[model samples]
Each structure stands twice: as C-alpha cells, then as structure tokens.
Target chain A: MNETSAALEVRNIHKRFGGLEVLRGIDLRAGSGDVITLIGSSGSGKSTLLRCINLLEPPNEGEIIFDGESLALRRARDGTLVAADQQQITRLRAGVGFVFQNFNLWPHMTILENVIEAPRQVLGYSRDRAIADAESLLEKVGLADKRDGYPAFLSGGQQQRAAIARTLAMHPRVILFDEPTSALDPELVTEVLAVIRDLAEEGRTMLIVTHEMRFARDVSTQVVFLHEGRIEEQGPPSKVFESPESPRCREFLASHL
Target chain B: MRWSVILENLPQLLHGAWLTLELVLVSGVLGLAIAVPMAIVRCSRFASVRAFPWVYIYFFRGTPLLVQIFLVYYGLGQSPWVRDSLLWPVLSQAYWCAIIAFTFNTSAYTAEILRGAIQAVPEGEVEAARALGMGRVVTWRRIVLPRAFRIALPAYSNEVILMLKGSALASTITLLDLTGMARTIIARTYTPLEIFLAAGVLYVLITFLILGGFRLVERRLNRHLRPRTGH
Candidate 1:
C-alpha cells in the first residue's frame, strides 16, 4: 500500500522502556474503511503500537503520518521525540480516537455526558450540537436509552458500547481499539463485539488489537501478527489466518484458534 | 444561677454567634480560594513547583491552631517592621488576624484533602480525557477537578466542621465570637455552666447546617449514580 494515500501510516516505529524495547521498527498502513487487526501473544506490543500512533506513548523513534500530514516531531532535551507543537498534537488526537481495554468512561458523568464531553470541550461544538451528535452516536451503539445513566450503573458490555460512542462523538478519522472486549464477561463479549461488527460494516477506518480470532477473521480486511515487539507477518485476513508465512504467526494462530 | 440572666444576655450571644458565622463564612470562602490553587500546585508534576505548597501546608498543619492565631495576632504585632508595614492596619485588628490565621490553617488541610482526591482520580479516566484531546486546563476544569472535588467532599465537610469549632480560637485573639461572648457573660454573671451550654448548642447547630449543606451537594453530584425511575 502507498503510505501517502493511506488514512494513517506508521513507519519504522520503535519504543523502549529503559532496557526493554516494546515496539521494534513497526510499519503499518490503513486507508479509509480499512479494518486492520493486530493479534499477538501477551507483551507483543500491539497496544503500544496503537498508542504510539497518537503519541500517547510517543514512540522512541519513528514517523506517524495521519491522513496526508506527517506528525511534526522534535527531539526533546531528554532525547525523546515529542510533538513540536502541543496544539498540533491536540489537533491530531482529535482526529485519531482511542478506545481502551478498560471501558474508561468517566464514572461521574452520565453516558450522554461522557459522549458529548470531548465534542463540547475539545472540539468546541455548541451544547445543542454536541448533545444532538452524542444522541445519534449513542443510538448507533445501542445505548440511546442508557444516555442518562452513569457508567457505574451500566453492565460491562454496555459501558464498553458507551465508550465506543464516546470515541465516535469526536468524529475521528481513525479509531484504535485496544483489546476492547478482553475485559468483558464471556456472555457480555458478544454484545460488545456486535456493536463493533456494526461499526466495521459501516466501513469505519479502524485499527483493533484483539485476541478474538474468529471476530478478527470476520471483520478485518487486513491482519498483522506481532511477536516480541516485531510484526512477524501481515496480509489479508485469509492469507494471514489460513497460510501464515512465519512459524511464530502459525504457532500463535494455532494456540489462539 | 438565675434563668433570667440567659434572657438578658440572649442578644449578646446572638450577636457573637453572628460574628462567629461571619468568621467561618469569610474564612471558608477565602480558605477555599487559597486551597484550590495551592492544591493544584501540590499536584504539579514538577517537584520544585510543588515544594512551595509543601512547605506552606507543612508549616500550618504542623502547628497548633491556637498558636497560629496567637502568632498572627500577637507575634506579628510585636515586630516594629510589621507595625510600620502597609499591612499593619489589617494585622493590628484581632478580627482580621483571626480570619488570616483560620484561613491559612483550614487552607492547609483543605489543600491536602484536595490533593489526595485529585490523585485518587483513576488513571484510566485521566487517560480518556487526554485521549479525547483535551488541553490540560480544560481537562482539569471539566474532568479532573469536578470529579476530584466530589471525591474530596466528605473529607472537606470534616474540615469545615473543624474550622467551625476552630473559630473558637478567634476569641483567644480577642475577637468577640460565640466563645468570647460566653466568656464575657460568664465573667459578668459568673454562670459558666449555663453560658458554656448555650455556646455549645450554637456550635452544634451550625455544624449540623454545614453537614446538611454538603449532603445536598454530594447528592446533586452523584445523581447519575442513582437508579432511574423509569425504563
């Protein structure tokens, strides 16, 4: 895939925690309507790579180009790559929404408040416009009726769904999911996955790090298999799942499948 | 031990109670103003910036409230520089001195309470705020502080009650608050038991009012936590 034309592209991203390198020279590209899944064993840096895209973890060395503009970076006095301008970072983050493994809904706020907070505060939308948009997004995630309810009052699946609606309220160009369903109960996982499936069907640009092999196979157009901080193999879902080139990817799929 | 002495001194006691209320109201407002900013400083990521509040909180929290009042009223009064300084007019009066002391003392405790509450805010929630692209000021104002203040409410109520009782120290600085009026009534009528009882009752009544006020705030903030009446 041509990097320039993709909605989001990562080139040779590297991240290190003291002596431990978490993401090693990772490269990824996603165009609009692309559903790319990152699957790997524990500590494979799938979540780290997703976080780096928004500079949440600020990759030690690499380039992230969102849409057509490359994220401007300057080496800090401490030798870390930080956004050259904070306003630029905030603007970039507004376009790249992140959904955490733990629902992370602000418990003090109602589901509707959680959804509308970013749009009103960060995006500076009027209250009426934000609430109007929030209701529609909540409707999309099947949580319109739960709008007035606090996150603590909701079930795990419902909270996750509300979280997705919150991310969508930002009108982001790319959505990153970090093990979205990993924290749910067995019976609840399907409910959240169904919402995600609906999002994929709607053709949202998404990057998902999930362990659910079947769901990944069904929803993702592209699949990347990571092993020990490096992408071992990547291709179309059928190619990566049915005929993984790397033995590591085959072993991971064998166990997970 | 005449019951009629209580009736005769009722107006005096009420006047003193009003001063006591004023002291608490003014100090509470001023203390909160000082504490909120200081608490934010206490929670600063940099150690150097945080150290200023650290020393302020430590100095006030370490000393006795009575001593703080004494120092502000008497100790500061003793200095020639303090006497000649532009602040002398305010510092010379027992009422202003008492307010200053109480404000500083309660502000220290309030700042500590707020710092703990701000720190207690969940990391995930903070991450969600940043992930949503909120600037630091907006995040603190809209997300961090609202939740932190809610978490700090119970502890803050305790501080308010303590300050209400602590205002009795104002009498030591010669500000005719409730306790001062009671002491004066006892001096004139020599009925310590009756006068002290009346003062205790007033303090108890004010404490209950503050408790009830905080309960209302907590209820409003936590309304979403309550179950909805309808499906």
Candidate 2:
C-alpha cells in the first residue's frame, strides 16, 4: 500500500485457465523511468502477467495499482471477472500502453491513421494535435516516410516500429511490451530493439517480457527471471544474469541467455 | 411474333422496368439500415441479445421468399389488428406490402453476411484497440465495422442482385413490376415466349449495372491492398 509512488504495482497476482495455474502469486512493481525486463522460458506465464497488468486477461485474484490508484473489479454472475468501474478502467488503460508480438496494427488504416486513432478516439485529442504527435512519433521510430502506407505494405520490422509509434502516440505513463520481437524475422529484431532502447533512454517506464537476453541485459535497469509462474530471482541485471541465487534461474538463463 | 403487338407493349414494359427499379432501390437502402445494427447485435455476448436476430435470419433465410411475401401481404392483411392499425392505410396498398416484405427478407441475408464478416476480422486488431483504451463503441465504429464492411462487400453485392430478381415476386401480389407487365402482355397478345424473354433480358441488364457499381466500390475500399506506386 505504501508503494503508491510507483507507476505500477502488482501484488500477489494469480491467474488460472480451467484447472491449470498460469500465474501463481506473482509480485512486481515499476517506478517512473524504470525499465524492468522479464526473462523466462515460454509458458512461464510471462505474457499472461503482462496481459493481467492491463486487465486484458483479468487475473482471478490480484491487486493492480496503476499510477497509485488500485483497480476496481467485480465478479460477474457467471463467475467471470469484469472491471467494476468501467470509466476508471478506461482512464487507467489510456495511461498504460501495450505492444503485441505481432504488431496488431489496423490493416484497413494507413500508418498515420493507425497511430492517430487512439489519441483521437480514446483520448479526445484534436485532429491537428493527434496528427502532429503521430508525425513526431513516426519520426522517432524512423518511419516518417511510410506514414501513408498500409500495414500490409510494410516489412515486419517496419510494421513493429509503426506499432511502437502508435503506442507512443498515447503518451502513456507506463508501457507493457509482450515479446515485441518474437514475431519478427531474426534480422528485423535490432530495429525494434533500437526504438525501445531509445524509449528507455528517454526515461519512460516500461515493462518488457522478452526472450532476447542481450537486448534485455543492455536496456534493462531491473531484470526478473520467472520460473514456473513465479519470479525466481530479480535485481539489477548484473546480479540476475551473473550470479542468480535460484538454481531454476541459473538453469533458465543457461538455456535461453 | 406480331410486330405491331410487340411495338405497342414496349412503352408499358419500360414503365414496369422503372417500377421494378424503384422497388429494388427502396428495398436495398432500407434493408441496409436494418442489416448493419442487426449484424452487430448478432455478435453480442448476451444470449438474449443474439436470439431475436438468430430467429429472424433463420425464418427469412429458411423459408421461400414467395412464402414470405404471401405471409406479409395476405396473412398480415387478413388480421383485424393490422386492418385497424395506424399502418393500415400503407399496409392496405400492395406496393408498400411488397416493399416491407422485400426489405425484411434482404435485411436477414445481409445481416448474416455482415455478421460472418465481422466475426472473421482478426481478434488482434480488436484487442489492440482496447489496449489503446478505446471503448467498445469506438472500437466497433473505427476498427470492427469498417473492416467488416470491406470484407462483406462481395457477398452483399450478391444479396442485392438476388433481391433484384426476387422483387419479381411482387407481381404475384399485383404490383405490376417487370414480370407483371410481361404477364399482362402475354394475356393480351398471347405471346408468352416473347414477353417473358423480354422481361428476362431487362433483369439481366439491371443486374449487370448493379454489378458494375459494386465493382467500383470494391476498388475504392481495397486500394489499401494495392502496392504503393513508388515504393
């Protein structure tokens, strides 16, 4: 409760699918300008944790305090979970951006329209301001020239960068990246990492779940290694990578890193 | 094959074509109005919300269009409640009854086409919209609806052409559309083959015209799929 200064705090979050527990009592927090990279083997619940952060897959049991306000949730009659206060959830989501592995850009819209859409429709930005911000974000992501092109025409790397620009257009306080490079070709990884590296350099708060160890080691201020749906070890990247206390962490790092 | 009889009926046949065009046009526009919302509702999470449209699509699509026309025209007309209602004046006319029946029938098919298209849209884009804080309504308007409409275009065009042919059934109700005029001409001139052949050709011409219009729309909407000119 005293961690109100943090931009995001997840306390004892638990998620289950049928009888399988995907995430079990996980705890995490991110402060302003903190770049926390979560490294885990596939199915260690990394993506589910990221999704739970934004209530995209609302956790069965947890507290998600974003920007100091705890989320309000209710159990539906069918024993399903839903946000208790929809308006507040909307406001909370607008402040937190999520980047998907596949770059989920709207295929029907041009890059510029895709980038400007959330700002205009969700945040109520004026057309002029949304376009202006979108242009600058595109420039930052090195995609200014491709603003008018549809997603189908772009390279996988270019599409991922465009997705980043779209996320940046929201001016989010905290951004969640769910394995942003997993869907790209090996050669396309660096361009996206470069964009994210720049965001980290700008002192933006980010929570990244990635398999790219070198990039995580390079960009993360804090590194977390998850094993079997729990954080096995977490600290400065040097400690987690160089001298992991947990045997599971060392085993995971040996295999993936 | 009397040249004099054929020449004398040309003007009346053209007028019938005009009436048939009006019926198709009115029904098409009105049907779209019903189809869009009903399609969206069909994808709703609540069972009760989806039930009405499911039954509507089942009833209209399952039964014959001719039966639908008869039910609306004769069955509804025979009811005392309908005869005494505010809509009685409009319902009493065969023209309005045909319009009502055609609109209802076409709307069901269009709704099903659109519902399939809407569901076919990738779940990723919809999730992305929500991740960016878009409400359900905004997500549908900006993302779901437009993309689904593009996907539904070819199917919708077919539905309309079918409706254009189906509008011929209005003749059975005494609306005197293209087929009705052909029947009248056959009765007077006793040339069933010539009169029916002429009517079939007129229907083919209108179908081609509508197909051309839809092609233009498809081109405009799908310009995004075309490769960029310079790069």
CAPRI-style class, candidate 1:
medium
For A6-45, candidate 1 gives per-residue lDDT tens digits of: 9998899999988899988998899989999999999999
Model 1 chain B is weakest, by summed lDDT over 10 consecutive residues, at B222-231
Model 2, residue A195: displacement in angstroms? 0.5
Best by DockQ: 2
iRMSD of prediction 1:
1.4
Task: Write out the backbone clash pairs for model 1.
Answer: none
Model 1: per-residue lDDT, tens digit, B30-138? 9999999999999998999999999999999999999999999989989999999999989999999999999999999999999999999998898898988998999
Docking class of 2: medium
lDDT of each: 0.92, 0.92
lDDT of 2 at B140: 94
* Candidate 1 residue spans exceeding 4 A from truth: B1-4, B226-231
Question: Which 10 successive residues of model 2 chain A have the least lDDT summed?
Answer: A73-82
Compute the lDDT of residue B219 as modeled in candidate 2: 89
Q: C-alpha displacement of A199 in model 2, angstroms? A: 0.5
